[model samples]
Each structure stands twice: as C-alpha cells, then as structure tokens.
Target: MQTQVRVRGARRWIMFGAIGFGALFLVVGLILAGVSVSFLANAERARGTVVALEWRNDHNGVSRKNRENDEPVAYPVVEFTSADGTQRSFRSSTGSNPPSYEEGERVEVLYRADSPEDARIKGFASLWLLPLIFGGIGLGIAGVGTVVALATRGRS
Candidate 1:
C-alpha cells in the first residue's frame, strides 16, 4: 500500500514538471516565431555571392576534451548590391563544418533598406528552424505529461 502511494506521488510530480517545462518552451517558441515574422515583414530581397568562408574553431569545454574530433566551422561571407546601388557585405550567421557554400556561389539575401548591414540569408533554416524545433519539443513534452496524468488518474 505504501509503495503504491509513493509511486502515485512520483508520477504526480513528473506530470507537473513536464507540463511546466513544456509551457515555458512553448512560450519561447512563440516569441521566436514572432521575431522571425517581424524581420521578414520589413526585409527586402537581393541576390548575393559568397565571397569567402570564415573558419572558426569551437573552443568550448566539450570540444577541448576531444581535440582530434574537433573541426572548425565555416561561415560564409556574402556580398550584395543594395537597391540604392551600394555594395554591402555581411557574414552569414549560420555555419556548417563541411562548408555549405562555395566561394562563388550565388544565394538570396534579405535585408532592410534602412540597415542592409543587418541582413540575413533568406532561407527556411535561417529563419524558421528554431521556432519549429522548440514548438515541436514543447508539444511532445506536454503530450507526454497529459498521457501520464490520464493513465495514472484511475490508479490513484
């Protein structure tokens, strides 16, 4: 009888914790989605060329543990001609170990007329990936909590 009571208590705590964390993640995802939408709303599109690849090393604690396994990430430097006939160059915020683009590759860029320096690469991964990931995780976790609560309700 006592063990059953303890199990019920543990399940209750687990359910509440999952629900709480899930809600937090959901809110963060919503906020990120909102920011992305706002950025796209004021952005103008232009064609850009990859001028260079900036290689950077991940010198964090985890990477330090495995020196042989560590590889430098390549961030592309893109140059574009703005609407006002001014040439601007900016480095992409996204990077990959294998280098996603060649030096001469042409890609789309999204920027505001007021501040072309703050432009970003116009792609689904650059803009929407984070929100989708967070929202998906949040929903999954919340669903787990709901399932647990429902399955154990009758036992208690």
Candidate 2:
C-alpha cells in the first residue's frame, strides 16, 4: 500500500512538471512573438550593400574534426545610409553556411529609426523565424503536457 501511494505521488509530480514546462514555453513564445511584431511594425526600409563577411569561430580553441568544414560562420557586413544621411556599417544578425549574402550584393534592410544599428535583413527568414520557431515549439510542448496531464489524471 505504501509503494502504491508513492507511485501515485510520483505520477502527480511528473504531471505537474510537464504542465509547468509547457506554460513556461508558451509564455516565452508569446513574448518573443510580440517583440518580433513590434519590430516589424516600426521598422524603416533602407537600401544596403554587403561590404564584407565577418567570420565567427565557436570552437572555443578546441581542436575538432574536419577543420576545413568547420570554418567560421560568416555574417554579412552591411553598409547603409540612415534617414539622417549618416553612413553606418553593421554586421548582420543572422548567419548561414554558404552565406545568404555575398560581398557587394545589394539587399533590402529594415531598421528602427531611433537605432539604425539594430538592423536586419528584410525577409521572412530573418524577421519572422524567431517568433515562428519559438511559438511552434511552445504549442507542441503545451499540447503534449495537456495530453500527459489529462491521461495521468484519469489514472489517478
């Protein structure tokens, strides 16, 4: 009888943990989505050119396999003139292998008028990815937690 009671208690704890994690994810996802939307709403458009590719190494000085393939991630360095006519250069907030932008390539940019330095490549991937990814994961986690909690409640 003691062992049965302990098992039931453990199951309840597990259910609570799942629900807590799910709520956390959902809240974070909503926050991120809100931030993304706010950024998009107040951004100004600008024409910019990729001037260079900044390489970033994440190996922490540790030797690893395929050193050639492990070449640093390259983020584009963009130069643009703000609405006030001041020229500014900033590294892109996003990076990818094979590099999404090449040096000298013209690209559209979205920046906050108050802080042009906080600029981003204007596109679905760069702008919407964070919120979409987080929100999707949160929804999935919350759904799983709901299912687990319901199933365990019935057993209890």
Candidate 3:
C-alpha cells in the first residue's frame, strides 16, 4: 500500500536524523572535553585579591524573591597581576547567594599565559564545571538518539 511505503520512508528518515544528531553531539562533547583538559594542563597560577561582589538579579519581573531565603546571586570581582606585570581585573564565572569570597580576600588564580584575561579562580568547580555539564548533556542526547535509531532499525 502507498501509506505503508510512506510510513516506512518516514521511519527511515527519522532513523537517519537521530543518528546524525547523535554523532554531532558526541563529537561536540569530545571536543569540549579535550579543550578542558588542555586548559588545565597549560594554565598558570597567580595570587589574586577579591575586589568586590557583583550582584545579579535573575528574576524577570517584580522585586519579590522567588524562593524561600532567596537572595541575589553574587559573583566575585578579582584583580591580579600577570607575569608580564600588567594588572588585570575579571569577574568570576561562579556565583553564590551568600557569596563565596569576601572583598579584600586573597585567592589563587589560574590563567593562560597567552591570554591573561581568560582567567578564573583556581578551584575544581571553576575548572571542571563547563566540561562536565556540556559533556553530560551531549552524552544524554546522543544516548537517546542511539536508542531511537536502534529501536527503529530492529522494527525494520
């Protein structure tokens, strides 16, 4: 029947699309993991001072807090001197409600020699978070796609 043929064709296309997306996600995850490893290997360490806490409001509307004991997220502003003797200031990527760093506190900083502006607080959370998050999502998506492709192939 024409309808049966069309359904088969549609299932074939779905399988192909799922496989393609799975491959794409796997490749992206691998690349991100590689970059994260490279950064860890080559980063230089320096002493930095926390200059301030930058507050951020995540709520789209109304001034009321969204959750119990909710407070504005605060990211640290840090200043450090590079090996080249240039002073650089950067905001930390990590934020917390109670604030992890106090102003005028000294902390370790990790940065690339070629690009000092690309720096962060030297810690496990700052270093490993992005790669772990991206890789996890990518692997989850790819796994789902793989299951869909396999199930469709078995039916065929």
Whole-model Cα lDDT of every candidate shown, in order: 0.89, 0.83, 0.83
Tens digit of lDDT per residue, candidate 1, span 79-120? Answer: 999999999999988888899888999999999889889888
The list of candidate 1 runs beyond 4 A from truth reads 1-3, 60-63, 66-69
In what order do the candidates fall by TM-score, top score first?
1, 2, 3
lDDT of 2 by residue, 24-112 (tens): 77787789778878998999889999999998876756778746567778899999998999998888877878788899999998899
Local lDDT at 84 for model 2: 95
For model 3, residues 1-156, the per-residue Cα lDDT tens digits are 999999889877876776677667667767877876888799988999999999996565755755554568899999999999999999998888788889999999989999999998987667776667766776776677678877877777
Model 3 stretches astray by more than 4 angstroms: 58-72, 96-100
- Best first by lDDT, ranked: 1, 2, 3
Worst 10 residues of 1 by lDDT: 58-67
lDDT comparison, 1 vs 3, better candidate: 1
- How many backbone clashes can be found in candidate 1? 0
**Against the hidden reference, what TM-scores do the models get?**
0.87, 0.85, 0.72
**Decoy 2 TM-score against native:** 0.85
- For TM-score, the strongest prediction is 1
Local lDDT at 10 for model 3? 89
Error of 3 at 99 (Å): 3.7
Candidate 3 Cα deviation (angstroms), residue 102? 3.9
